[model samples]
Target chain A: MKGNEVLAEAAMRAGCRFFFGYPITPQTELAAYMAKKLPTIGGTFLQAESEIAAINMVYGAAAAGARVMTSSSSPGVSLKGEGVSYMAGADCPGVIVNVQRGGPGLGGIQPSQSDYFQATRALGHGDFYMPVFAPSTVQEMADLIYDAFDLADEYRTPTMILADGMIGQMMEPVLLPPERDLSTLPAKPWATSGSRMERKHNVINSLYLSPNKLEDTNYERFERYEQIKEKHQRQELMSCDDAQIVVVAFGAASRIARTAVRDARKKGIKAGLLRPITLWPFPTKAIDELCDGGASSFLSVELNMGQMVQDVRLAVNGRASVDFYGRTGGVLPTPEEVLQAIEKVAAGEPVVQSAEPGAVGSLLPHPKHRKSSYERGE
Target chain B: MADYNHELLCVLSGFGGQGLLFAGKIMANCGLIDGRQVSWMPSYGPEMRGGTANCSVSLSDDAIGTPFITKPTALIAMNQPSVEKFAASVQPGGAIVIDTTLAMNGAEGVELADGVEVAAFKATEIAEAEGLKGLANIICLGKLWSLTNFCEREVADAAITKCVPPKRRHLLEPNLRAFQLGIDA
Candidate 1:
């Protein structure tokens, strides 16, 4: 199964009865698959007018306590940000998948990790956080879709999946998860299906008035985010315990990192990989564990110049020096290239001589120290 | 009997309808059914238009990296342009099954520098002959079985059977026979 199909299957298993999406490359097949499969299992699938409508439809169904989802590419995701902020303010729970393709515009429909900043940082708005899960494989797609729902509902926040077109279109054997028994799940308290006399009408609203009132609401959401960062940070570590080099990545980028690590190992350089499954609750703990005693050197690898690198530096917090490697404009670096970079760092050479920042695709610099636990990339 | 620890396949040129994508999917699923790690990826971007489409399907005993086949060990060509574009990229001594009915006319028609050429004419012919030309992709896949030693009969046969509709079960024998003809033709 491909990641998009796995995502659809995972949603069905999670009791998602509603999926609304518009057609876009890389992600179009996802919506098409859902259109076919959702109806077979007595679920509702809709092809909305635009990404705006699709995202808002997700918000509407999520308000009804249904496990709902919508998906789009990078540009479409940028359009859906308004709905995302509205969903966040409403405290609705659902999954939004961005099977990201290239660029700041319709750059290309090929796979890319450039959407990291858009997904992790607030894309649409005022102080808020939407948990982001990044899956690199078909099995991870199913696994993280389930995880996205659980965390979204538990925290009463929207959860986003930041995966690239490669992950979305690529096929792999996915270990289909056993269905979750929705019967065992407790009923949500704020669903608005017009309860009639059973209960009073529940309104799902994101509108807040007065500066202090909005601030309180924001604080409460942050409180939940803090809990999430503390408890919901997800990561994967490969051969890092006794490693001299640590390469950090997530989603499709992580899969490439794995190949580099293997090459590094073959060349006698102890290169390790740390992959974050959840980009929002950026797995700082794992990085800290790797860097604690100056035992591991760090390198942040992403498709974009350095979106995720900022998070890596934050995770290490000057406990260890950090370096960067990247490729952009829909071009992904091969594992051979990444391994070469790792070898250079291992040889005490600045593998990356300089990462030029442009007006459009500027290389993100190492940020200054900020007194915070983590920015939590989603 | 076809079996290997590593199998890499490239399927090219989309917009020829979904036939190529379907073929790659069957192979990938078959590899998985045979208990192997498999990766299948199709070409996107301008390659889907008035151009050739390419997809890579890989099967290995070990984990796979980069689903996109930068270089391939096995290939299946269903159209003339597909044959022309992908034939040159096949690994030396690797197997390439071409749909001769549409692609192979003469030695000048194929551009491959190396690899054994197995003319695959029966796929569309047999399917069209049997009034099921839509199964041409699978027929070619069956024919390629003789050329591909990575996946075994038991697994590929079962995968093909399961992937088809129950209503189409009556067409199974013809597909199986067409595949055999391609392998030996």
Candidate 2:
């Protein structure tokens, strides 16, 4: 099955009854699949007038205690930013899927990881962070969607599945998850469903007018976020025990990096791959431990203009050098290009340097760093 | 049987409406039925209609990496432009199969180096003669199967049966026959 189709089926099996989404390229198939299947299952699949309307609908369904979801591409996601922040503030549990395309404004409809900063750092308008899952394969895409909903309900927060156009459109055999019994679903006590003169009316809102109460809510949410980081920092470490160079990547880019790692290994280079399955948790501890285990350097390979490299740098903390290679606007970096970058780092050459402030490829020089035999080519 | 030790990456390319993606899907499904790992990624874009359409299929015993097949082990070109575009990208000793109905006459039309193995077949001609007009892509698949034996013939048949939608079940017999014709040819 295609990744998008698998995601929709997995969402159904995960008990997603309310799907409010607007059609967007690369992710339209997911919504279309839901439109066809959700009806037969007695679920609601709505195509809203706009992205903002779709996200707000998600908020409503989530507050009503239904497993709800919305999907969009990059530009569409930006339109839902305000509503997403509202969902976060209200502590609503739902899933948002961003099948990212190249973007700043109506960018080309091609796969990109440029939304890394938007998804992990500041998804909406707040100091809050959402747990973002980046799946490397279609199977992982289905598995993560199946897992995201439960995590959302457990934490009472929105979870985002950060997939790119490549992963969304790619086809691979996936094992569909077994359906959950809707009758056995856990009760949402905070839902705004009719109280019917019950014990007390549950008010689901983020609008705490008092400053102290809002501060308290913020503190409690941060506490839960910290716990999520500690317990759910998922990563895949490949050949890093004795590797001198570790390449960091996620999603489709990670799959390419893995191939490069294999190619490097065939050429007698001790290379490895570190794939961050959960981007918000950032998998910092995993990279730190690998560095402590004698990995000499780190290289971040991404499909954007190098966004994830900053997190890798913060994790490494100048203990070893970190470099980056990226291609923006949906241009996929070939494995040979990645292999070449790996070779440069293995040869102890400074392949990239911080050309400007806050740039992604910012390479801080170390006193112990060796000189490069080759200069940066253009 | 196909070699299970190494991976086989193949690209099937042609113009839109030529069933390139469908042929690739069937090959990937065959790999799955045989219990080999497989991935199929098509060239998705605005140009997908009336433009050069292609899909990469990888079959491997172990986990495969990078769904994009830059250096394919085999190339199935269903049109002249497809052969011209992808022939140079085949790895040394890799096979290049072109539909002689649209591509260069014989193997001399394409400009691949000598180390590459080239196979040319009148896929469209065979399909037309067999009264299976739109089954040219299936015919090409049969040639690919006969050459690489990536999966057992039974697996291909089963995949064909499985890939077609239930509404299109009536075309199964003719499709299989077209596939077999290319294999025998």
Candidate 3:
């Protein structure tokens, strides 16, 4: 199955029965799959008029103690951000999927990892963080959706599956997990499913008018976030021991970085890869340990205009030289480009630690694979 | 036997409705049937059926690093524009199969990178002769199959069986016949 279809089926298997989403490129396949399959299994699938309405529907269903989900691509996700913040404020548990596309405003429909800042730092208007899983493969895409639901419920926060269009459109063999029993799920006593004279009626609201109560609630939420960071941060390290340089990437970009690391190794460049499976916790300790293990340089690669470079710079903290390479606006970086960047930085060339995105130093050279200007009739 | 450690990357390109994506999918499924890791990614926009389309398929014995292919080991160009655009990107010693009926160049006057092999054939004409007018994609796949032999012919047959939906089961026979004609050619 395609990755998006596998993800939809996996959501169903994980007992998510309420899906609300609008059609968007790259992620529309997931919504279409849900539309077709959910109804047959007695699940509710509704396509709202807009992305904002879709996410709000997710919020409503999640507050009523149902496993709910919504998905969209780049611009649509931006539309859903306000609803995301409201859900966070209400402390609702839901799953939101961002099959990201190239963007600042309706950027081309090709794959991109440009939403790193939005997803990990500020998905909504508030000061809150959710667990964000960046899946590199189709199987990981399916597996992460199941885990995201569990994490959301445990933390009472919205979790996001951050994938690019590449992973969503790609087809690969995936083993879907067995269907989960909704009956086996943990009880949600805080749900607004009516009191029925059992005890006190549960009030699910984000509006704590009193300033002191709001501050206390914010503190409690931060404590939970701290706990999640301490326990749930996930990363995959490849050949970091006895490495001279380490390459860090997540999601689609990591796949190319992985191949480049292997190529660098073949050329006797002692290169390793650190793939961040979870972007939320930032994997700061892992970077620290790599620095401690005598890694002299770090490279951060992404399919965006250097959005994640800031986080890596923060984590490395001048312990070692850090360089960045990115391909923005839907163009993907090749393994050769990654290798060239690592070689350039490793060969005693001063790393251009530029924070300015799309600068000549921060991007791999323009693709020679494209038709020349003359051939393009320019 | 092909070395399992050596990965194969191929791209199929043409008009959006030319079944290029399906051809790529079949190759990917063939890899899966042979117990190899595979990834197939299509490059099509919101308007899927009228514009230019292409897809990349990678097959490997180990985990595939990425689905994007900048320099493919092989390519099948179904139209002139596809050949003009992608011919320069084939890796050294790579193979490219071109459909001669639509790709007017026929491997002549086309400047390619070093050591690339170009196979030009009238695939659409061949398909039409067999009353398989829309099966040129499969014919091209067969010719490419003959050159690269990425997997056994039987494996390709099984892939076609798996790729064709149950509702379109009747298509399997004609596609197989078209594939056989290309192989024979």
CAPRI level of candidate 2:
medium
Off by over 4 Å in 3: A352-378, B1-5, B113-115
Q: For residues A295-373, write the lDDT of model 1, one tens digit per residue.
A: 4578888888778888988888888868888777777777876887787678876755223322123234323322244
Ordering by DockQ: 2, 3, 1
Cα lDDT of model 3 by residue, A301-335, tens digit: 89987888898889899999888877788888777
For model 2, the stretches where C-alpha displacement exceeds 4 angstroms are A352-378, B1-5, B104-109
Q: Residue-wise lDDT of candidate 3 within B26-136, one digit each (tens)? A: 999999998889999988584375767899999997778879788788999998888887888888777889999988787677787787878899999989988998999
- Ranking, lDDT, top scorer first: 3, 2, 1
- Candidate 1 vs candidate 3: which has greater lDDT? 3
Q: List model 1 lDDT by residue over B36-122, tens digit each.
A: 888888776666774667688888777787787655666777777766666677666666766666665522555555545555564
Across B1-185, the per-residue lDDT of candidate 2 in tens digits comes to 22423678999998899898999999899988988888998888864868889999999987877788888888899887788778888877677778988875545655665578777878888888878999999988898777778777888999999988899999999989988987897
In candidate 3 chain B, what residue range of length 10 has the lowest lDDT sum? Answer: B1-10
**Which residue runs does candidate 1 get wrong by more than 4 Å?**
A193-203, A293-295, A352-378, B1-3, B9-15, B46-50, B104-143
lDDT of 2 by residue, A1-378 (tens): 888888899999999999999999989899999999999999999999999999999999999999999999999999988888999999999999999999889998888999999999887887688889999999998899988998899888999999999899989989888999998777899999879997599888878899999999999999999899989999999988898899999999998899889999999999999999999889999988988998888999998867998999999999888888767778787877788778889998755433222233524432223345454332
Task: Arrange candidates by TM-score, descending.
Answer: 3, 2, 1
The DockQ-derived docking category for candidate 1 is medium
- TM-score, candidate 2, chain B alone: 0.92
Q: List, in order, the clash count of every candidate structure.
A: 10, 0, 0
